[model samples]
Target: MVQSLAGMMVPADIFLSWGVQFPSVLATVAEKAAEAAEADGTMVLLAVLLSLVAIYTASKVGGEFFNWLGFPPVLGELVGGVVIGVSAFNLVVFPETGGNADNSLIMLVLSATAGLDPSVAEPTFEVQSEVVSILAELGVIVLLFEIGLESNIRQLLEVGVQSLVVAIVGVVAPFVAGTVGLIAVFHVAPIPAIFAGAALTATSIGITSRVLAEIGRLSSKEGQIILGAAVMDDVLGIIVLAVVASLAKTGEVDVTNIIFLIISASVFLVGAILLGRFFNDTFVALAEQFQTRGRIVIPAFILALLLAYVAAAIGLEAILGAFAAGLVLDETEPGKELEELTKPISDVLVPIFFVTVGTKTNLSVLNPAVPENRAGLVIASFLIVVAILGKLISGFSVFGVENINRVAIGVGMIPRGEVGLVFASVGSESGALSPSLDVAIILMVILTTFLAPPLLRVVFRDEEPEAAEPDTPA
Candidate 1:
């Protein structure tokens, strides 16, 4: 390719394409040779790989330290990302986060050692950052799929009415309180406030459920209530996101499109699960015939990714499809085996999701010394208060269970997790949220996420711990 493109100014994408094979020290050195051959071309592959190195290093170190302290490892990963991301080290900064070749340490390392040209640094960082972003997105998808696999639909159904009430209140309370407060009190516009309210509706089922599993309460009655409600929250959150996204995009709400999203999302989730169940035996029989290394896992992976794509294509989040696929496959005979096999993949990919969320956060706005930042802090405080109080009240809405852990249920739903980041990103990209408001939303997300796990441990500490469900596999 270098020989073919010689004497032409090589595009950044050529290096990006070669980035499919992850770069090594050898690859970095080889890139110097390639640079020699194609004088006009510069390598971004090394920069990209080095960024991932920083990401993984931060994830593991933070995760381990947090695990040691008896907090969620995912929280540590987020903090580690903040330390290395735009907020601190600049080693893992993204283009959207005011990071560029001039600011990124990894890109500088490449320019110094890998012969990456200074002139192409920005373009290189753009491609490299976009790749990292895509990986982070995939990480969340895998995390949700894993959550789905672990979940028992029967348990969710057993607590269906309570979960429904909790989910509805959990969503409505935060949304109404946030939107109205932002508008009537803060004087923010209706659209941006609505978007912010929608952001509040997310319950990071990934992190919350992960915490429940880590603490051995995952199959408890309270845990089941939280899980079922979180799933419902995911569905309802999508509808709210769609409505706001449409309003933001066109400045006019499309009621017709909104209805379609609601119907399609419902039908897609139910139909996918039903279809997966109907075909489970056939899938198992075909896998039994293969006797191959990845016979079960590979097909399961394909189904997950395929369904994820379908969900996204039909105007819902891709994670929904991946999750539905997991729920379906969990009912199959080889479910446990497939889950064990899938763990390694989830371990490799899911940290990227948590860490990147931290990386994109600029908590610098919360500083009290800066007068402009003070306003953001005020708004952030308002949001943080409403966000916590609003969701915390959701547990009381759960009806008719003896000695039910209402506080535990509310605390479980407090973490908006990565899904809140999705809402903020959408609003930011669509110009719906002002920078101050954006920072406020981010603060709400980060604090809520970081606070949930320890709070869960604290809330459930006094209760007689419920035994794990007999049918639910660890």
Candidate 2:
């Protein structure tokens, strides 16, 4: 029977008829299935999963490639994001449709079946994009927490007057440069100018610390000063961000509110440190009794998240809380173990945050042919120059510290990295900065982040090599 059925030759007309009907039937079935899935909200889940796969794959490959090239892995991740994002390949897109709407495979499939125009259709927010955005935010929180874990409050105190001077100068100079350059030179409004300046006050400890560690100079005197100054910069930067953000929201800067915010922020940080110290032993003891896996790590992570929530609740950036949690967790008996466990988590999330930041950057404004884009490029150029010079001058602030490569320190402080991105994101969301200004800020961030690592390597080449050691807190 099988042989008879296999050997049966269909008539040419019948064969042609089946072949034509097959695709039509299959397409009909698929269309119905898709409609059913949409009704059940399954399409949203599928889209989200697809997005995650795409984002993580792109970020990992990009990060690894950059690492191989001897640059910071984050730079590679950022570049990769730009390559795959709407501004480049259009592999991923947001709710709005236009431009590369036709280029995105997912968008194409949806648009075709829905009878939507790729160019003119208004797309609704997919569940997947929202989830991706939330995860990206959590990634930043984890990144800040990891930074805090590596920091030692005692070491920060030990760096003393030199670090203090450097930190102050670093924060103030950039703030002045950004504000003055935008307002006086670019003729930007006062509120937006303030936001731009606040962005410059940020110094990415993660970038500078990683560079120093890679060069085996993390424990050097200059490294110590840079770390200490970075810590101070984080504190000052957050305060400035809070004040400026408040001003942007209220349309006025209240002196009383600014002073209160500064005091509140300081008290919260110090209080968190003291509270963590007091509870460290108790938490460790409790963790030891838990027979289940991830005892120490789980509890520590919860603490970080809890603090982050509290910080956000109190009108401060959640990163400050995450940092404080790390500081506190560092004092635990299982601190080293917690750090080891947390490293893998950070390894996954941190790159996602960086890549997401890169993807959000609109490269269209940087085009030179368009008159408006030309103006934006000019503004970006001026901002980049100011950003570079502002931090460069801070390296010379340490007058009393001898034998320290001030140039290296200055270069070390130059990369704004994730911190600047955060500042710009906040400013844009709050409507404090115009789209052009935001793009300019991102350009400044990208240039500074990319420039610092190479410049630091060059500046440190003449110095004697320091022995590689485990990271110590500062």
Candidate 3:
């Protein structure tokens, strides 16, 4: 049968009665490849949309419950993140988190619900996680911009001298106390000690600014000083980070870079405000020409993004630029219109920033059951004390301001938040810090961030609560 079949001439287009094509096989292959790529891209977008669903659910439920309990909604948003994050349900874990996000409950649900291919699951989750992270970052940027819009520039300037004092003390005291005590008592090596000490100097401008705005004290004299000091601390924190990073890489600090960072930060901030003032009239005039759907907001957002980009290029925080953009727009005729438009956008995005801050935190580092974590807990205790007291004391360092809630100023600077993570990450990556010391810094950051919101409310409880969610500057 095989010989007969082989001998038979079956082709030649079935003896010229039929035809088949073969050369387009490569084109077919390419078409299938394109389809697969498109499918994968769609899956990534689906995954991101699902993640946002979980995020928004957590944020709102947590926020409402906490707000009902008479606490700051930000606290609930954080706790919500902790619940859904790597520490708990794994619903919103990041990719670097041991690939747990790919196997998270949300991802699994997505797979089961969508008939997602197992082969593409990993890449989809990775891309989804990254997109979420970028959105979270944008959230914080918008938060800072909104804050800058609400703040009184003249008021901040009024407390500028005091804020400078507070920022300097906040940086120096913790850095000295934590660094010296570690070397003297723990006998930690110089580099690890310095890196850990550097961790103490960060003040979460995002957290403090949100809390101040919530309690309606954002326009208060004390609030102005705290926000101003926090911004200054951010610039100083970057400088310290640069110095320590240089030391870690080369065992030498860059004096010239430090000087340049200082000068550039000052110039960037001053120039942003000056330019804003210089262009206020022109900005307003330009706005009058646009008669489109986003007439009021599009221009303002463009300015914010541009300034944020310039600030990053100059080695300063992008939020500073966004904040500067807000200040500039606030001086324009469209200031109120811009504020109204920004609120809805802030509502959508800012919660992602708060929630993600909680998600990235690994509470496992504080487990006393683990012998390794025990040492971290012990060291964390010391750092916490130093972190809290060092910053609190700086509030009292504010001189010539009578009847100021010096404690609030200090407490405002207490939360290390995500800024502390930058230091810990660098230390771990450089091998400058032992696992135990790294964990200790994480604990300090977590506790300080968790504690500051309630503490701020307590400190300001005596004062009348500012209008909850004030739409205009006080």
The candidate maximizing lDDT is: 1
| Clash-forming residue pairs, model 3 | none
User: Rank by lDDT, descending?
Assistant: 1, 3, 2
Runs of candidate 2 exceeding 4 Å displacement: 1-40, 96-104, 109-124, 214-216, 468-474
Give a tens-digit lDDT track for model 3, residues 1-474.
Answer: 011122321212222222343555335434434434534677777888888988888899998997697555666777788788878888888865554535677679878898778777765666577678778768877876886676556655666688989999999999999999998988878878889999999988777877898889988888888888886786577557656754675454467865666677667767888988977887788789887788778878888999988875544556668877887788777787889899999899988887776676667877889886776777889999999999999999988868889989999999886567656655664567775687678768867887998999999999887666643231
Model 2 C-alpha lDDT per residue in residues 1-474, reported as the tens digit of each score: 001122321222233345667886455445433433333244445555656777788888988897798666767777787777767866666543233334565555555565444333222224345456667778888887887777767777788998888889999998988798788987988889989998988888888887788788998998988989988887778767766776786676578977887788788888999989988988889788999988888888888999987876676767778988988888777877788888889877876677776666678877787788887888888888888888889998889667889998898888887778878877875678776788889888878988988898899998887888764331
Report the alpha-carbon TM-score of model 2 versus the true structure.
0.83
lDDT of 3 at 83: 83
lDDT of 1: 0.78
Each model's backbone clash number: 0, 1, 0
Q: lDDT per residue, candidate 1, 357-470, as tens digits?
A: 778777787778888788788899999988888888998898889878899999999998767876776677567888678879988887898789889999988866655533
Candidate 1 off by > 4 Å: 1-42, 204-224, 238-251, 418-432, 453-474
Candidate RMSDs in order: 7.2, 13.4, 12.5
Total backbone clashes of model 2?
Answer: 1
Give me the candidate number with maximum TM-score: 2
Total clashing pairs in model 3: 0
What TM-score would every model get versus the actual structure?
Answer: 0.82, 0.83, 0.74
